[model samples]
Target: MTTTDAVRPTGPGLGAVLSDAELAAVRADFPLLGRTVRGGRPLVYLDSAATSQKPSVVLEAEVDFYEQRNAAVHRGAHQLAEEATEAFEAAREAVAAFVGAGAGEIVWTPGATAAINLVAYAFSNATAGRGGAAAEPFRLVPGDEIVVTAAEHHANLVPWQELCARTGAVLRWFGVTDDGRLDLSNLDEVITERTRVVAFAHVSNVTGAVAPVAELLAAARRVGAYTVLDACQSVPNLPVDLPALGVDFAAFSGHKLLGPTGVGALYGRRELLEAMPPVTTGGSMVEVVTMEATTYAPPPQRFEAGTQMVAQAVGMGVAAQWLGELGMEAVAAHERELAAELVKIAEIPGVRVIGPVDTADRLAVVSFVVDGVHAHDVGQVLDDRGIAVRVGHHCAQPLHRRFGVAATARASASVYTTADEIIAFREALAGVRAFFGVD
Candidate 1:
């Protein structure tokens, strides 16, 4: 376990160049990759699952807002307000196009967690008969079941757990296999006649296993259940189409896709979002307010209450455009190459990759445990060399329990990750055992 060979370089293996030219150039736009850390150690950032580094385009979009049109959006007759509102809505359109969704189908929230919570809260209100007409489709009773998975991050799991607790609905979940894929063989039992809502992650955060969305959706559809997908991990890395995925609702974070933090989107079918009750009430969401009753606006605006994250949304829109320019298929292909190389490193002696070994069906978010060493110590060793990775259970305690470990060391890749960086990460990991005198 001595430090020797590094992880393989993420670029083309040998003399030949990568076919994706735009992806090669994408590294230049992220300013952070240019900097050195830990007294001149070249920075290797592989924690895109937590938050992606911003490209210049996204940064400039936010800066442009502050400089040229720093005014409130949607609630203004003034010149600056009009300008701001136009830019904001343009951003919204950009996001909608990125996901193959309509402007009305998208609602901005604080982040993925908030977006998911908004839906959950709305569903809760609907079930309780508290949201008036909007509550019609969401009413679940005592025998109703909400389906989730052991692999879901807390954002997707906790809300439903709370919803079930509040509504007296039964909660059922798919378990995780040893390789970290969801055990969906019991789909019939897990999503039964009692299931009113079915929610799960598109790709597991800890395992990187891409769930069988088509099959999962079909099972839910068979049971007449509403589907909610947590796309926080997948949306940033892959080409996501909600209409194609056939989910009733989807949520993702902007920060994980190189946009600023504090903004994310919830994508619900136009009719579904319109029928769902507003979780937060006040301000622009309302169309008409009387002393006794108030009527809310339509879909996107109705879900978006209070002040909006104009700058964040604008930045996210730019991020989406930037990714679109590169082509999502190319992005997916580039990362698959990186994952293939990184998986080789995990196969080395004393390394145990946490997820499915199949590269074709996974994201680049690989987690693993190194023999004779704690993940925290390994993370510190890599951090000392300026290689950033995520370490721990990754907010999926049930998943970790299935793996028979409390925590793991994760190395996630983005469009910017190079083969050399992955190599350096592996080399650093090889040194961990020796650094701690464990070998």
Candidate 2:
């Protein structure tokens, strides 16, 4: 079957909400959503930010690849190799189109973390006298600055830190506001002429805040800095067009998009990818090699080394096409409804929201702290009722520090998530303080 053939198509029209019946059908697409947990209390998964559950169509796509076409991609002229390569490349095209990119601009990586690392290390390689004049744009000088936000996940923050450490570049950052949004009010100060790179999230994974991309992009353009977007949170939850956003590079993982975990993609503008040197060197990435030296392949393949993740890419492509069939406007509208319901958690006594208190320009994600109750204790109480939530700093320690808390409990929503599930989660959350005698 083709990538989207097995997917159960549904029509929810533009800006249409997934009604109760539509939601029931959507939930049925994922087998895990129907399973029970915590002594059969019915699993209420609110942790899509951490990772998303796979639908049967995505699962089947992987299995179908391995069972039917299990040869190495872009290698042999055998029939299986041709088919595998076809499926693999088709996936790149699908994911590229999903984000408004061309297939040639997409490079496969293990995950978004690895994708970001690839770009950082490329800069490191360029600064160390690699890639010649073509890589001048990637080079960093001693006084050059790399900027990130305080709200960055460790994945986005740490790689740039290492890049600066390797290249003698300075690291700068934008702070967080009281409401957990990017404090870009002083954008001119944070991103200046010396800023060589500026990295930030499209949406806060912890705060559910949609970033002001247009404002940030304009600033980065003013300074001629390359913009890298940590799009892991936004790609699955919103309709993202990388080119339209005007980011120089963007990264997202397949697992969070309802595909397999072993695969993700990095999208670089075609010209930038050609200029950027490869971080990993091996088999398929070479154009020509000898005992003395080796020449590299073009972009995309230049960064992808060794055997590719063929089956995972195939599944991710299907996931992208699956979402396309549902229409992103509708997907976003459905989540907005869930976001409205989720924000009500802030209304619970003794609970304080860590992010925006309202649903405006945010995802269906809420992180909150309960008065006199540790976030871990709150999570434990909720888990006892078969509700899964992410507790702790959520990989954003600096952001939590900005909020004057060590950690907070975060409940996130996905396509299959329902309003009733949010209600159940809220009811369970309401009793968390009482369970610990902090009510």
Candidate 3:
């Protein structure tokens, strides 16, 4: 177990998905990649699942907004406000287009967690008779069931748990298989007629296993239940079409998609959003407000309370445009090559890959545990060599519990990841057991 005689990976390996020159150019767009870390060691970042490094274009977009047009949107008749409102709305349209959603279907939230909470709280409110007859579809009775998967991130899981708690509904979850995929064998039993909602992650942050969206959606449809998708992991790395996926609601964050951290989007069907009550109440979301009564605006505005994250939204819009120009299919292909190399960690002795060993229908996110070593120690060893990775339960405690692990060291890739970086990671990983005297 050593770095000696290790051969570096080369090319995109996915035939012109990203030419060597184009790949190099794409890497150059990320300014942080140019810096060295840990006493002059070259940085090898592989934690895109936590937060992607911002590209120059995205950074420039945010700076440009603050420098040129910084004003509150939708509340003023002045010139700066008008420009800000237009820019903000334009960013909304761009982000909506990126996911194949209508502009009106998008609601601005602080991040993916908030987006999920918005829907959850709306449901809680509906059960309390908040939206009147319009929200009857969202109401949950004591015996009604809410379905989730064991592989869901905490963002997608906890909110629904809280919702069920508030509404006296039962919370049930689909099991994860030994191979880390959702165990959909009991789909009919799990998503019965008593189920009112089914929520799951589009791609697991820990295992990188792509959920069976079509199968899950079909079951939900058969039972006449609404579907909520946690797209935080998939939207950044894969070609996602929310409209085509036909989920009733979806959520993703900007920071995971090469944009800023303060903004994210929730995509709901227009009619559902219109019917759902706003979770947060404030100035901008209202149509008319009195001392005793208030009427809210439409879907997008109603969910977007108070001032929005204008610059962050603009940066995310630029990020969406940048990814669109590169083409999501090529992005997925490039990452597939990276994942193929990444999964080779399982070939090393005493190291177990936590997900499906194959790259099919998966993104580049990979997690593994080393024998006789804590995940934090493994992460520290890699970090000492300037290899950045995530190490922990990764917000999916149930999935880790299912695998009989407390935590794992994860290496995730983005569009900027190169074959050399993957090689570095592999070589660094090869030395872990030996370094700890476990071999």
Candidate 4:
């Protein structure tokens, strides 16, 4: 067959160069890909949206950390300590460059959830009218409103809800449209002068809809509201440059982006991070302490309390470098092809996709429901076939409620996903109706 014919025959009718050899090469880089599941079925991991499989490069980096450079950082007296500190700080610079921010602006946290809570808790302090010399800009008061969206994951929503309850500030949010896109029509009305903080997801975890970030930031700027973006989904799947986006704060996870768990980074504009009080106070975060009074370190260190996840940070840094080497443009192109395939699967009979079919404006997260088949059952059938997918609310209960469904089966793709895997997923999903004896 000719090259054009080979490419054109692929599913979703897209013209892209996806070779089995290329996919095989990529698969070899993941140690888990060589393993089997359910006794002897080759794993077809389609749940990158939940957490990605780590590459060998990232794994080896973690191993190297413990084997060669295992020591405490920031307070070192000897050679190994110095090496550990250097590696840890280099990891910070790598993370900073990963999302287009300064090294000093990146604060290490346990995960995206912790990072988001840091921002929310700091705002809670502000709402209580607590301010010293450094805490002036974060102050929020009664009648102040915080704006979010109905599509936010619980990590993004619950913190703001708790903040509102603690501070007497009203919590407002933009609802979803019938098509599963965020209804920004009420942008002006929702983000008024009373709105002190505006927190939203960069990409909906359920709908995969990309928010109008520029427009949203413009609205928030007019009202002088602090903007906090939950980039847990976007940073892993898209080319994110937080500095250029002009958000005051952002957070994302390392595990979702091909790194280890227990390590994530929060990016705050230096001035903003400096102005907000640390949510968790402990040994490393303090500058000096007396029986009566205590002083805290500036910005990043202030927010980072207790012992750091040194090895995980180094591994994440390697993952960031790996993604950087492959180039975000290449990763985006690969997932775009995968998204097109997912859209086609959604078009199958008795299948109802939960979000917009437009692949251009969204990431590769595809949530859908099979007629008369429970999401858990659908997930089980796929699992029996060695395909992994996320079933249930995917941690966005409000979004599921908006779609008028109790649950959904989500298949998310990443740079490693191939067209053949998508095809296998579709075929497996097709078997669900017949097996369940549903129309």
TM-score of predicted structure 4: 0.94
The lDDT for every candidate, in the order shown, is 0.86, 0.91, 0.90, 0.86
RMSD (Cα, Å) for all candidates, in order, is 6.4, 1.0, 6.2, 5.9
Off by over 4 Å in 2: 4-6
1-439 in candidate 4: lDDT tens per residue? 1101111111211233335665566567788977889879988899998999998878877787799889988886898899888878888888899899999999999999999999989877765655476676677677889999999999999999988888788899999998788899988999998988899999988888888899999999999999999998899877899999999999999999899999999999999888887788888898889999788899789988888999999888877877766567667777888899988876788999998887878888999999999999999999999999999999999999998898999999987888888999999998899999995
Model 4 alpha-carbon drift over 4 Å, by segment: 1-22, 129-131
Cα lDDT tens digits for candidate 3, 1-439: 0111111223344334888887888888899999999999999999999999988878877877888888999988999899888878888888899999999999989999999999999999899889879999999999999999999999999999999889899999999998889999988889999999999999999999999999999999999999999999999988899999999999999999998999999999999999998799998899999999999998899998887898999888878877876778888988999999999889988899999999887778999999999999999999999999999999999899999999999999999999889989999999998999999
Between candidates 2 and 4, the TM-score winner: 2
Clashes of each: 3, 0, 0, 1
Pairs clashing within candidate 4: 126-140
User: Which candidate wins on lDDT?
Assistant: 2
Per-residue CA lDDT of model 1 for 194-246, tens digit only, reads 99999999999898999999998999999899999999999888888989889
Positional deviation of residue 188's Cα in model 2 after best superposition, in angstroms? 0.8
Our tally of clashes for model 3 stands at 0
